[model samples]
Target: MMWTKCLCLLWALSALCAPVNKQRQRMLLISFDGFRWDYDRDVDTPNLDQMAMDGVKAQYITPPYLTITSPTHFTLLTGLYVENHGVIHNMWFNTTTTEKKPYYQTLFVNEWWDNGSLPIWITAQRQGLKAGSLHFPGTSSSYQGEVAMVREVEPILYNYKNETAWRENSDKVMGWFRDQDLDFVSMYFGEPDGTGHRYGPDSPERQEMVKQVDRTVGYIRHLAETHGLTNSLNIIVTADHGMSNVYRNGLVEEITLSAIPGFSFRDIAFHLVDFGPSGMLLPKPGKLETVYSALKGAHPHLHVYKKEDMPEHLHFAKNDRILPIILWADPGYVINGYFPVQFHKGEHGFDNQEMDMKPFFRAAGPAFRKNLEVGPFESVNIYPLMCHILGIEPEVNDGHLNATRNMLVTSTGTRGENRSILQNTLTGIAAVAGFLAVVFVVVTSRQILKRKRKDKRSGSVQHLPEEENTKQTGF
Candidate 1:
């Protein structure tokens, strides 16, 4: 009985300690800015192809509307729409301070980056796990007053001149995973995006950049294999958004805000323009109707909307950061006051529903299923999936685990099911132990009572025999 009780105690202790003894699951999220879904079809990416065959690949990952870098990337991290997260655009006017901050300038301000919803890294850190980021958006700012354990001190710069930067960053990330033992790590690459902008998406330069990016992937894979972490490490390669080619050779008419009648730049208190494919105007004081009417049908390729009347599907209307009037350009058109002498050959920041705006998503690791092709899912869904793989509870956000659950092996038998099974098994063992303990006590008590009765009866018989002998002798 004692042995049985001791065994039960040991089993309970082991069960309690199991999570602490198990190896921690590691995740690495990599983003290639402006990497379109079809870029792989354009270039040779054997490493990515093998990863897809070995793991899971999305048909396409749809980012939120106004598909720009900061907003979509932040959405992926936080699992919230732009309106909910408060990063309404890549560059928006901050009404609180009445200052206009562009994308690059917004990186330094906490107000622009720190939205209410916690990002995956911040959430992981809050749950006592370590996280690291290499130039990922939102890593630069503190979330709910907590920052990641490790992140780049300065904003990551795109060194087009230095081709070796990607490999170096990969090595740094691998070090964080293998040595620092970070639970989650995110890395960003500014490639193909830059190349696409400099020379259109279909240009040879963009294709070469794609190949170069693929080589970087191969480098990271080789490092993972060398460290015996290929199976243990979950690596996700995705992009913020995709790129679209813009017509800049006068093949298509240029649309500019300045061309609109009564739409003088002086009438705007603060505005966001000159950036391609979209524009936001905050009319000075009461020029709202005048500005809106002037820019409504100003160009054949442009579409204008009042902030409240913006498409509900875009989820971009409710935020205060969104200006009084929003502008969208067609796929091949660029929206600016004047065509620059040096304009980007390609651009983004259009309606996300367009196929050209879809980004690529591929993941490989122990947690993900093999060779699966799924999705046309919202990019926001990635947050919950990431939380599931890392074994952390996700925050309240716009994503659902069921959307991407099919991509994971454990999802076949749901996590709750596995947990219930474990609980049932442990409960059965405990119940059996308790039953044996009760039986041991009952049987032990019965044996003690029986022995005492036998001793008492034997003494009475011995005494009787002694008494009979004395009486017969009659001394």
Candidate 2:
């Protein structure tokens, strides 16, 4: 009897951790770099509009701070803030040697990425699921000697604006799922970001690019159906960060470090600037105070912070990869170094709190509630959501499963039946455990009473209490 109770207890406990779905649904996570929250508002995005009608759509989703390509994307992959995950910059740098690797080159530098945390791809693969990546950041580099089971890296100077390439990538990824039996795959499209950077977010060129993106979105879903995966695969369409135009044409003075009255680049040991709206300066041993003062009040648009004094919400200052005297510009401003060398009409990497910094989120397919428009959620929460759909235990992550819970639906479920599988499972477990406890108590009490009345004729008095049975539900 003791063993039976123990076995039942163990079984209940194990069931609590079971994955949400009995059959793992395939996941396709797609990122359209620098796709702003409102990109569809002004454009005719019928495909995206239909996606909203067919699946769950967020009003918008917030990206982590350092809102650049690599860091925020890593936040999605790892569910950790930039500082915690340690990919603080898109361009990986070594402050010691002052050797910096450009964004594309950094993709191959294992040491630049594999800092204590692991991305979802590695996590899923390790948990008996096969995973693949198509030009996603952090895909090229191996994690603790394990890379994605399959991956593709774009060539240097690859044209990000190519629509045909996106379709081909989508077809290839679907093939990987059907042919290779892969459970998870992440795809990245470097568009609208490049278009936004070159022509500004408000330019007609960017609007045209957004149309291309919409077409690509519709095309991907069509391929999913053609591949016979529409009923079984879950798709997430999101971006790392959004784009904003760099203010120029005399509306405001550009922020130039060299143009400041007392500031001099000679005082800085190693500096990262002129990249975009965010930068950091490592002052020489004795030059810290002067350097900080020169840049502090130099311009109203420029914001400078000592590493220790950075805002807690940014979650960017703690990492060793970050240099001292970090700085950023107000939206529409870029930090210029010696001269205004960069002439891109648009930029990102601003504070995440800015509306322009937030990206869009859309999810669809078998596992999601249709036509559900959810409110904003942090991008970090996406990792746990993916883990839930994959039916795998999540790694230690900052994301909360409940943050995006309203989006999921079980098989053959309606909008009202959107409660999580784990919730239903636990409810049933509690009822059963309570029943077993009551039965044990009643039986023990009956035996004791009979023993006490042994002096008289042996008689048994029994009462069985009815319980409200709790049933498990499936979606």
Write one digit per residue (lDDT tens) for candidate 1, span 99-195: 7766666776887778577889988887778999988877788877888899984344547424577777888889888899888998887777888
Point out where model 1 deviates above 4 Å.
1-23, 95-98, 153-161, 338-342, 411-475
lDDT of 2 by residue, 215-315 (tens): 99999999989988887788999999999988787888999899998899889889999899999999989999999998898999999999999998898
- After superposition on all C-alphas, the RMSD of every candidate to the true structure, in Å, is 6.2, 9.2
Q: What TM-score does candidate 1 get on C-alpha atoms?
A: 0.84
Compared with the true structure, model 2 gives a TM-score of: 0.84
Model 1 steric clash pairs? none
Query: How far is 283's C-alpha from truth in model 2 (Å)?
Result: 0.7
Candidate 2 residue spans exceeding 4 A from truth: 1-23, 410-475
